[model samples]
Target chain A: MSLGEFELIGRYFRSMELGNAGGSEHVTLGIGDDAALISMAPDKQLVVSTDTVVLGTHFPPDYIPANLAYRALAAAVSDLAAMGARPLSFTLALTLPEVDETWLQSFAQGLTDAARDHRISLIGGDTTRGPLNINVTVLGEVRPRNVVRRGDAQPGDLLCVGGPLGDGGGGLAVVLGESMPSSVSDAARDYLFQRFWRPLAQCELGLELAGVASAGLDVSDGLIADARHLAEASGVALHIRLADLPCSAALQAWPEAQRMEWMLGGGDDYVLLFTLPVASIRCLEVWASQGFDVTVIGEAVVGSGIWLDDGQELKEKVQPAGYQHFQRKSND
Target chain B: MSLGEFELIGRYFRSMELGNAGGSEHVTLGIGDDAALISMAPDKQLVVSTDTVVLGTHFPPDYIPANLAYRALAAAVSDLAAMGARPLSFTLALTLPEVDETWLQSFAQGLTDAARDHRISLIGGDTTRGPLNINVTVLGEVRPRNVVRRGDAQPGDLLCVGGPLGDGGGGLAVVLGESMPSSVSDAARDYLFQRFWRPLAQCELGLELAGVASAGLDVSDGLIADARHLAEASGVALHIRLADLPCSAALQAWPEAQRMEWMLGGGDDYVLLFTLPVASIRCLEVWASQGFDVTVIGEAVVGSGIWLDDGQELKEKVQPAGYQHFQRKSND
Candidate 1:
């Protein structure tokens, strides 16, 4: 049966209990009128980020709808985490070639699960008929002084990552049917696939490191590539110790060179990469003790560009070989 | 030369003087970061809305880039206007099939013009490779008590419109090469085309009507259809006088039947439709004197659905025949 826009929304999205709909302190209005009304704490500032994921480009055309929805939201919310902002609400502007009720149902379920995981409400959205694309604009709040910026890292600051790298890339390979060696177990494959489909946003870690991290951003692009952004923004050089880069067991199962490539150049990790003063190392340890998985991978120095130290020698410069959208091969 | 996503954004969108960059009280941080930071007055509530306009569906494939961008932003910002909120900032998530530098430049120029006209900043955005789609999320601020809701119109409230109707539909017809009668002058055609390309959002009027309007919304989806939404929300019947609809002279140049159809069933007008207490007629007149063209169309009554009064007889029922995304014929 063909569903009109309102009926489709009413049947799947509007009826779902995604939180903060009827009686929310901050969300005065949600998902019914022309706009959504929200109120933040007196001392808080609003933070917003938008991300778009397209079929065939961001994911395989046949990818599961639920997982695609979850990943789309996770990627958008990761920006909020990068800003050290508390997730409040998000609006999804979804375009579909056709309305498949079953696909929409699964997508909505996944979106609801993601919303619950991120502790954010679905405030308002627009659905249109077009190529399959999901654009999520996430709203968050943070105390002005506590917010982290990408351009504040000073020389002699320690560079850190919130989680392991390369799992996302490895998972993508697995999803694309890359043949694994006999050493790769089912558990490892499952772990990597989970990482690809449900890369967690480091919200709690970001909030905790608000005053500690001098410069920060989420690693949507590859670690080495995204690190250059921080370095350029802060006008400092990042010296990354190649051996110190964190890797999940699933990623480590691959060849050392492949794992290293993924570690340095895999995109969609959604891990927070940040810079903190040497004096804040103690705070990092404290955060680690409190269940925040942070790994010190490098240092910021008074220079330019990214330098790779492989324990023996320091590589002069590194290229940002992350996934560039328009530069990629056409899906056609 | 093919442009990477970052390079394309930096070359066109980022460098544009769309407003509220470098130094703005509300926009603490604009583009180039993970998210945008905005702070509003303590007494104001935040209003937000998202809209997605897709190529081949919302606009023709060969539509001018600048006009398309302007119209997209205007449509999204119109939601803020409908909520009686002051425009602040917006984020754009644009998906394109390919990177065309010339098209990008033109689109950016149009977007810049729209942002300047609306007095809103392009704080953040995302660019991805996909079918052409523009999703804009707009944020605004309004005093809590002054906000107009769709569910608050009393039975005796007078229904009013902020501006002329049917011009948008008439303009769309012009754009689609609809042959007008010989009597339709060139000036009228030019006016209609302009109306289609640059439908102004009644933001100032919405803000002015905040306390005066009991209930309100923008007329995006035809008059009778959208009026039904207001009626349903208010739990009252809207009795609209067909002859009382404010139509532009350009639209009036069409045949009477065609003009009536366009007036009753045209979409994308982006004008404000509201209900006010009879005691506020003086306020309406005062607003009219100040260049806010508001016309009283009918009244709300204790019933359900929409009742049309054509001066001769009252039509008991009317079907909503607005533009619906998925239900329409496939572009394929």
Candidate 2:
């Protein structure tokens, strides 16, 4: 209860083992120093991203520490994945209300699991006393030529998503104790919960799409909202077919209207959404054959904004809608 | 009052100008994407540090947003100075309770001034809604051979400080409305306040000290406490001559006892504390001639803890004491 900052950091963070990647070769000096020193590969450029999650705003007040930790790190690392970068290291700036050893232990465990899964090293961090807030700054590397950007989508590019959508939103509904139809099975509920709590970064798929995909980003701000960003950035229009949007079996248990809303407007799926030329369809086949759940649910056109095409003959222009941190009361 | 996150970021952060350094050549992509891309020089290793300041904990709740922004960044960047790294870029993770355009404008102005002064570019950041917290992750680079470390001190190495100490604590007192003696002029009070609010990182001195100083760190954790860290890290003892410790003229106006306590135990004086070999004293003279206030204050010894000599036969071992975030009720 009366832990010093140094002791808390030493016990919970510094001594923790890194994931499968172990210590990074780039690390010259790590935790306990004024700054961490990292050596870089000569041919690689660094990719960096920062993400902050706050209690009550980013997650429910009573969320599990371990799950929150895992989700936070994974969500941050997903940026690197979106950019086709390999994980290198991350620093955590954690502000907590009090010194709770149990919470710290669980949080550390969750971080360890996430780090291992992501193959990144924990280089350094700052621990402070305040409201519960976690800021993760992830550093990664990619060859300059292999790096992907949002502003390179060609007009005729095929718009694709790495995997299923709507699961994260559905999972959030389950977490919030929203009433599920009596027909929704316990296994489906469990699946949705897992999707919400442990959304994996599509790193491998992103890497494969590096030179192949014209432009890409992770589906964090819902399929339609995020696609609009890519469209605007690349000066093209995105046409997404409602029938082609992939949904997990768990999410499919919901009504068609609810599933469509979650798929198009709900956020936090962490799957890669990208654009590739028609020639790269073979690559998609290769990926699909290799057990990747990549699906082409849209296309890039010469116009602007986003369009939704139902199975019917009608096509409607849709406004971008997703979780905007300041606009919304709370966010994922 | 109801600004979206993107609009807020675009208005305040993305459009800010860099200091005299202008935009960094290392930046390939900045601000708009999922991640910022930075190309690094092959021969130089990267150095990074993260620091967080929370409202009510790190500063008074009613603290000015601009001053807080400037102070937060300067303090964080001081770590790069401590490591003798050249400024490159930084990312800010900011959480606020509400969208106050007036507060944001002032804060952004402060950040702009600090960025320009430090010659670092803002690459990317995250804006979230929550209790006020600012987390800055700074990235810099240094050649492999020119790097300094805390665990490299040698016995008989002369201990030196970059400049005067205790002004920060004295200034904090001024900020907190502490009563000052009539003998302390308004000029002295102003000087103290500036020291607390705008402590410059001794970056030029730190860069010069690389390879010259056997070991070093910025004195943010008080003189005696920080010396203990250097001593322990290097497996040596540090002996300080009480008479030799430097105090700012403003701080000297206080009673000798209070001045000594602040000089010995006060935090947030971002001056470089380092150990130099006796053979390197000429370098110190060169630095002094160049207007650096470098001063020898002690020597590293063969023992294992910090010892204080009051210019007499009696030498007493001193316990390390400084602000620890978790242990203390509030911290700077």
Model 2, range A13-46, lDDT digits (tens) per residue?
Answer: 8865344374387788888889998888999999
Give every prediction's interface RMSD. Answer: 4.4, 2.9
> DockQ, per-model, please?
0.56, 0.60
- Steric collisions counted per model: 0, 2
Report the lDDT tens digits of candidate 1 across residue range B1-332: 13344575666877653343321458889888899999989999999999988876335667889999898888888888898999989988888877888899889988888887788888888887777888899999999998988999889999999999888778888888878888888899988877888777988999998888999999877786678789989999888988799998877677887887777767678899999999887988799789988999999999887787843322323233333321332211
Residues A297-316, model 1: lDDT tens digits:
98999988888784332232
Candidate 1, Cα interface RMSD: 4.4
Task: Give fnat of each prediction, in order.
Answer: 0.72, 0.70
Candidate 2: Cα lDDT at B104: 92
RMSD of each: 3.3, 3.0
In the range B129-216, model 2's lDDT, one tens digit per residue, is 7888899999988888888889999999999999998887787778877887778989999888777877778778888987788999
- Could you give me the TM-score of model 2 versus the true structure? 0.94
